[model samples]
Target: MYVALFESSHGAVLQPLDESGLATGEARDVGASGLAAAVAELEAGHPRWVWDDTSRWYPRLLAEGVRIERCVDLRLSHAILRNSALTASSTLARSAASSWDRAAPETVELTADAALFDFDGPAQLNSAEDTLAEFALQRAAIAGAADPARLGLLLAAESAGALVAAEILYAGLPWREDVHDAILARHLGPRPAPGVRPAKLQAVLERLREALDAPTLNPDSPPELLKALARAGLIVRSTRSWELKKLTHPSIEPLLEYKKLARLLSANGWHWLDTNVRHGRFHPEYVPGGVVTGRWASKGGGGALQLPKQIRSAVVADPGWKLVVADASQLEPRILAALSGDRGMAEAGAAGDLYAGIVASGAVATRDQAKVAMLGAMYGATTGESGRLMPALTRAYPRAIGLVETAARAGEKGEIVSTRLGRSSPPPGPVWRTSQSEAYGEGATDADVSRARGQARSWGRFTRNFVVQGSAAEWALCWMATLRGTLDELGDGAWLTDSPHLVFFMHDEVVVHCPADAAASVEAAVRESAAQAGRLLFGAAPVTFPLTVAVVDDYGQAK
Candidate 1:
């Protein structure tokens, strides 16, 4: 059953629908303040809720201590179907932008203090009728898809990801402020006041100034520092660590140290802790499907996706709880193994270390070489040592390499390539098409041809990686959804933080915060869900997606 939620005069209208989103029963009306109780009661039926935006509606229930099992986020689902190659012929895909395709809210926080659902005139689909109509359209699109099962699974996984993102946001990661402060102080002396640098950073700056012989040099100023480096006869293009490392000047060490420390101070320093971490939790707002490849992205605050290793130790578990961190091992490579039906590649990953298995299989002389060659194949590398090792990799894993090579060729020809689940690459832009056209036109300049070729190769590389990365993302989502459902079942009727819930999710890594007693069960669920996700994506496929599971007291010890 699908229960659609919409804005009513002073509350919400819940219309229960069948699998295809057609009304099957009488609707229920609930007020703004009582919405949480209404949803909690409805949980008995286990109906998948349908809402315009999960970010807009679910937070209130979470805030009220209510949790729903499943949901269909219209906005996210619309984005997928609209661009999906499988649903190209459907009305929803062909139609222009509508309210169902609205962007993510500026602030994802929608408390119970306001109306149950935010309304924006008739332009947005906030009314009950409009919401139901949109749901019907989405169902029609999925039903008419070339591969309905695959597209439906994609939508389900995507929506589940939305729910997971919101839940994780509410159940913020446990943070240790004192530990963070200690880490900062150890690396960067005492925390500096206001705009001043820390003592250690100041010392490094002094060394840099002394080495460059620029008495007033500001290491923070890239242009000024580059000028000083040039004056010291070290001509470099930029202040990037890699470029600076090429020149072994006495200033190089201090300059790199300054850059590292300054980055830490700026990105995740004391101010960041004060702003993002609240009440001993780092509440990050995650935007699911934020990246074009369907990967998640953190909003302005939190810096959740880019949590620096310098402060990872601060991600501590509560006293009675433990952090269960598990990252799928070599996820993309394993995804490629399944997507291509390459038995050799699948066999290489069967041992849990794909690169090592490849070396053992005589694909490459060393594990490092196998890794570099496999990466080169997936990323369309045609030069350097990685490129040189590609022939051996291709010979060993023909189907796997061939799959990416075909995707790269399609991309070079300005055609679309899709992942196993149906999320297709966007078409070449008008400018790119024009460049390709001009390069082949009469009297085309050599420079134009060269530029067009370079652009084609660049796009080819992106498509080559996209199929694997995007499919890997789908696999990760399925894993999370499966893990979430199993954990929910194991919760024995508890909600949110009271149960084993996901606290953090990176691209391929997921961290669950659970009671010490449930840690072992959660670890088992994590491994079980990984196996299930592979089967869901590639039924009976031999690819083994192994995970490195860690039950640790802090995130720093997870790896």
Candidate 2:
């Protein structure tokens, strides 16, 4: 019987069954216990169904020849899957909390005609744990503080700040918990000494409110309220009695405590701070082609490869170690140049910064203005300030503008676009078609349709961008492949993948977590990869993409 489990859009386990294993073949009146009973008998025990035929449809999809190979064992899958569960559905989390005071046993057993392999093996478990640990450590190093206490606090603050930011930035959008967790985990490395406590921070805020004569407040006010008060200059007094700044005060204590808790959570299956082998060396994970537009990802460390300039304080190298960072400036624009075969855009990139060139070419008033202009032209952003400013940019960068505009039109018409390397976009289905028609329908007074059209336009813009971005991703993949091969030739002693391991990815950048000795070679590998990416994408284009290089002891400086 083809027992299957499928995940709903909401990620709930859905098990759809006919009397037998087939989804559309035959129907038999049978209870859930029939298959359960049979499987139980076959396994000779009550096999804990982690997920079964009634739970998910993706597994059963294999029967229809939807090819998918397992990347890790069941145990590793369980871990990743469990991680997903922690934030799966907010409602579900609450429900799970109420349903089980203790952890529930989750198990799965399956007998397939193809192959039966043990997923929860020792090597896989160890490897996964190590990966997680390394990721955690790399983040800690990037955050600045060397000691565990400070690191914990930094992590907590960053997480809290990000949670607040996400709520503010995308108020109505559905949030993915994994995205939240990853964002929270990104910059949690280290902090300066004498971290504040979360509770104390609260008390300080209360006192500040009392001082301001605004004591009559809702008890359920968000922590961001206090932050706002602080920003507004109403909460002026520092909680610290000494010369230490506001960050080191008793009021910030709760934030610190939260950090300590986060540290504990992060330190799962690993050693504690003082005695841990990570002594002063700050190594960050590098993920190439992580972003939708061929950027990079940092595994655990904050985006050390692309950290903001002022925050480079965290990554202090060991005695012999140095950070060597390289970034492709105006990458997206350059990719646009190649994709569109735009001489103007290519010349702009060749001259230097695309934005600067736009300004110099009299395309826009300033570099910042050029951004809004170009973005507006490509995506058909004909509203707000962008609409007012984009015409000149389009006139100046005609080829590039034409490329994205064409793509946008194609997307609006429900057409597919492809990356250079066969990564064709799937056509918009009935929903998209209906939405577009609704958006462009005659005699339509409602702006919802227009708004939807704009969205469709943006998707076209995205698809257009994706062709360049996805192709760039292919290039990055090739670079990584080449780098890995090259490192293999250098032997384990001279070079290693463990340090500059590929961990995280986003669009337009790369981060490499590396040992001291491997830094230079890794730098070379990075450059070579960029060159390789160029070769892979353009074959023989006149414009060569150059990565502006920087070497820093800390990740914060790289940005």
Candidate 3:
């Protein structure tokens, strides 16, 4: 059964629909104050709640301690089906663009004072009738897809991810401001006032100026620093760390230190602490399906995706609880093995560390060589050590390497490639199409053809990684979804919002804050979820997705 929900003039309106998506009953108008109670009553029937946007409707319910088991996020589902190659022939895909194709509304932080659902807002697609219509279109599109089951699974996983995003935001990551301040003070010295450098940064700047003999060198000024470096006889083309490291100069060390500290101060210093962290929680706004490869992207909260190792200690669990930090080991390579059905590659990944297994198989001379070769194979590397090692890797894991090679070739030809579960890559943009046409048409210049080839290879590198990355993201969604269900079952009879639940999720790593007693259960659930995700995506495939799980009070102690 499906229950379609929409915000109307009265509040939230819910209408029940049969399995075939036909209306089964009249719509019920529930006021803002009664929404939670009405949803709680509907939960007894296990109906999949269909809503226009999960982030808008779900967070308030979660705040009220109402957790729905399943939902159909129509907005997310619409984006997938409209662009999916498998559903291209469906009416939904063929229909002219409407407001449905518009970008999602900007995500906003939900406060306690905010209304449950806006009833008197400007008219949009939140009417009960409009939601029912969109739901029917999505269902029809999925039903008419080439591989409906796979597309359906993708939709289910994506929707589950939406729920998890909302939940993770509500139950913000456990953060310790004191620890963060300590880390900052230790590394950069006491936090300096606005527009002034910290003690350690000032000290480094003094040393840098003396070393370069510039007296008034400003490390923050890139062009000025470049001139200073040249004057000191370190002729470098760029000030990039990798390039700078190649030069030996008294100023080099302090310069690098200055850059590192400056980044820390600018990206996640005291100001960041004041703005992002609230009430011992870091509420990062996670955008589900944000990346083209399906990875989650964070919009705010101080570089949530790029948390520096220098401050990870601040991600401490609450008192009397533990943080279960688990990351899938060699996720992408293992995903490649499964997707390509490469038995050799699968066997190599089965041992937990795919790179070590590759070395053991004599695919490459050393672990580093194996790593470079595999990355080259996936990323279209065609020069230097990676390129030199590619032939050996290709010979050893033909299917796995060949799969990426095929994707690269397709990309070079401006063809679209789909991931394992049917998320197709978007076609080349107008610029790329124009370049290729210019290169191939009459009277084309040699430079035009050369430029076009370079662009093609650049895009090829992207597409080559897209399939593996996108599929790995799907696996992650499944992993989190399975773990969420497991945690809910384990927390039965307890208020889940205050019980053991997921608090943080990076690309492959997840941190669960739970009572110390539940650490073992959570660890077990993490491992089980990895295996389940593998089975769900690639049934009977020999590849294994192993997780390195650590139970610790501080997230930094996990590894």
lDDT of 1 by residue, 40-142 (tens): 8888898899999888898988898888889998888887888889999999989887776645222212111111112221225467877788889999999
Candidate 3: tens digits of C-alpha lDDT, residues 90-157: 99889987666644322111110111111111214666766888889998888888999999999899
Best by lDDT: 1
Comparing 1 with 3 on TM-score, the higher-scoring candidate is: 3
* Model 2 lDDT tens row, 257-372: 33334443344201222222143332333322223233333344333244333223433443454555566776766777787788877777777687887788787788888888
RMSD of each: 5.5, 18.4, 5.6
> How well does each candidate superpose onto the true structure, as a TM-score?
0.94, 0.50, 0.94
lDDT score of residue 478 within candidate 1: 98
- Which candidate, 2 or 3, has the higher TM-score? 3
The lDDT of each candidate is 0.86, 0.44, 0.85
Better-scoring candidate (lDDT), 1 or 3: 1
**Ranking of predictions according to TM-score:** 3, 1, 2
Ranking by lDDT: 1, 3, 2
